[model samples]
Target: MNQTQILVIGRHPEILATVIRLVNNNPAWNATGCITDEEAMSTFDKQTFAMVLLGGGIEEPSEDKLCAYFTSRNPDIKIVQHYGGGSGLLSAEIYEALE
Candidate 1:
């Protein structure tokens, strides 16, 4: 079976570390973490990833551009916008819509 891959984008060290732990532990995703939209985009452009977990708590321009760039490059790629703070608050709406 092909392993699923994900790109995680966020600036919060603590939160990012938590996500890295969660993702690394999950059998479903081979997750890679990035600190900025630039790093995320650079990595994305170089290889194929099954999903992107965009830190919704990040700054506007960076988030917007990353979303737009990813959408434009691979419209099929799944994105999970993580609204850092609480786990229960994460939006499934975007995931559902993509499905």
Candidate 2:
């Protein structure tokens, strides 16, 4: 099976790490976490991702910009807003986004 590439954008290091770990738990998914907009953009340019999870820690304007950037680059890319939740919720949200 092809692993789905997921980009996680957040300002909090712990949250980012946790989300990355959660997403990576699924063998079908590979996740990359970025703490800054610049890093996110650079990573986005370097690879093709199936989805992007914008963490609650990001500022509203930054999140909006990142969503716009991702959609503009690939209209089919799925963008999901992720507030901190349990592993089950995270998995559900990711699965929903993929569908």
What TM-score would every model get versus the actual structure?
A: 0.79, 0.96
Clashing pairs in 2: none
For all candidates, the clash counts are: 0, 0
For model 1, the run of ten residues with the poorest summed lDDT: 88-97
Question: lDDT tens string, model 2, 1-99?
Answer: 999999999898998899999999999999999999999999999999999998887888888888888899999999999897789999999999999
Candidate 2 lDDT (Cα, whole model)? Answer: 0.92
lDDT, candidates in the order shown? 0.75, 0.92
lDDT of 2 at 89: 94
lDDT of 1 by residue, 1-99 (tens): 565677888898778878766666646457688997778889999889878888757888887788899999999888777776553343343335336
**Model 2 segments more than 4 A misplaced:** none
What candidate 1 gets wrong by more than 4 Å, as runs, is 85-99
Candidate 2 RMSD computed on C-alpha atoms after optimal superposition onto the true structure: 0.7
Native-referenced Cα lDDT, model 1: 0.75
Model 1: pairs clashing at backbone N, Cα or C within 3 Å: none
